[model samples]
Target: MENNQPIISVDHVSMRFNLSKEKHESLKEYFLALAKGRLQFDEFYALRDVSLKVMPGDFYGLIGLNGSGKSTLLKVISGVYKPSSGTCRVGGTIAPLIELGAGFDMDLTARENIYLNGTVLGFTPKYIDSKFEEIVEFSELRDFLDVPLKNYSSGMVARIAFAIATITKPDILIADEILSVGDFLFQQKCEARMQRLMSGGTTVLLVSHSIEQIERMCNKVAWIEKGRVKMDGPAAEVCAAYKQTTK
Candidate 1:
């Protein structure tokens, strides 16, 4: 990162969900139980008192075991979930590749969905028209443009999603397991694109399981264990420590 000012800041952030203990047969039954004061619940905290900061132009990686709240934390950053307590703040626009096929319409053709998903991501129709070919070129799915997205493989879907998300180079790019869906060669392509963005002063926050990838790409890292930050530092130090514990 080039600047001392944090482009993204998380302060004592905590996300909590109240899961109902009782399962009702129907909507009426659920309402009846609620009316009778018979409802019970348990609190599940996906993130607790977690704090971190990302500087401008940073390639920050988040590493953790599955179900360790890595995705949840990304959701919080993406504004998909509001924290039960604390705050998450970002200084600039965010392009989030937080889920596979998130902004796509499965029944629609890949061509139709480019316009659909593109508008949803805040691009104007004229703007999309101008950049449509570039998006297709990067995805390398020109032949499949007329095909329904439902027929596409996961890796194929990933290609389109990533190409669209990275088209304009927003102030911050947030990714969650995006590289894992693609084949090795495709993964390298994505990394190269990210490096290009980073060199142009874009900030990146990524969540990935590949330790080697994290070590190679990220200058900074945070190790989350059981919904809390277990360690945060330079990638080499954090990844090495995390590897030892897992071993």
Candidate 2:
């Protein structure tokens, strides 16, 4: 697939965060606390020297343990966060399903949120209008579409958000642990829809801890550890390597 031409290119990307301790001294007590040494802020690197290329129609899996910067990398790719150093270029329109209901307004009705979410995913109102029925059916939220999102359960919100985010087929689809939501049946449905998208030539970048899901869905894999790529190769091979290291 390396010869297929890259749809996404991440070059030596690094993300850093500054952590500072808050002061808790009153004005009257400031003089007594002023003798404290200068506050030292620790710099945390979420992702360091990360680089990869994703080709069109490739189902790329990013696997890592908690705090391995998998989510940070996804955010950088989705433009939610900028890298401290390095370059990232995406060739086509991107739809990011990083967090369920992340961008939804709890006070808005599900119907309204559909348009809002769809717009954020770069879908025109007309496009959302055309796919409205399909999205509702997929989410099984037709009866609750007019109700405020706050009244819906978390799973319901996830379903609705997933449906809305996927209504418009994007050139690049980025998913971060979205499979952990909903019931077993809904998970099956979501997986089927994802298969359809991949078969239709959409590039997919999936971040998940589920090795089974990665093995079943992805052709290539990148194992990330401590904010760096530990290994990148065929899905089965990389997954095997990850399992060995973790165990």
Candidate 3:
């Protein structure tokens, strides 16, 4: 049974990072400045007063220009960063494909990385064993399963990561620019897999620069600019407005 409540809630969230102004030629200078308390810095807010609510089973898209906080918001929801203010609440299990090879060991074989990443996502060894073949099949990397991940191309790594993440239905799937990495055919395959997951009641939060992709796959869209949400509404309407701004 699908619940009427929101599965993900982000309320007035803000994230700030401190960046140093001085550039050091060497590590010694960097450490010396740090010890002398002479490291001048500035604060940059990646997200400011951003609030959002995603209903259960909703396919939500976040659209923004580069450096416009789209990925930051996903990171916040994924618990990769502590908000500078406000709160974010999530219901049920989450499978996050925030960055390619984020949870993977580059030195390990593709097959080994799958098991390692599965464990990180809270699956037992036996559960991973059961899904091993399915993941490999979907990844289409059966030939490279025993090869070290560092040897694979970016697209190949993305394939393995996507296959591992979506091996089972999760309550929420957070994707940040994942579709942009793979080839066109593989991208279509991933989209089909996501559609199946949505039908099975998985809520998805997607971040993409491709407005067309967002408009096609998402039911709702949020447009973020300069660390704040400029628009939030139906996918088509919001995407139309965002496109106008870019032109």
lDDT of 1 by residue, 1-247 (tens): 4487899999999999887777787999899999999887788888999999999988999999998899999889888899999999989889999889988999999999999988888988898898999999999999999999999999999999999899987999999989999998999999999999999989999999999999999999999998999999999999999999999
> For candidate 1, what's the RMSD?
1.7
lDDT of 3 by residue, 182-247 (tens): 999999999999999999999999998888899999999999999999999999999999889889
Question: Order the candidates by TM-score, highest first — what do you get?
Answer: 1, 3, 2
The candidate that achieves the highest lDDT relative to the unseen native structure: 1
Query: Clashing residue pairs in candidate 2, if any?
Result: none
Per-model TM values vs. the true structure: 0.96, 0.92, 0.93
Among all windows of 10 consecutive residues in model 1, the one with the lowest summed lDDT is: 16-25
Q: Estimate the lDDT of model 2.
A: 0.88
Model 3 lDDT on a 0 to 1 scale: 0.92
TM-score head-to-head 1 vs 2, winner: 1
Worst 10 residues of 2 by lDDT: 24-33
lDDT of each: 0.93, 0.88, 0.92
Worst 10 residues of 3 by lDDT: 16-25
Candidates 2 and 3 compared: the better one by TM-score is 3
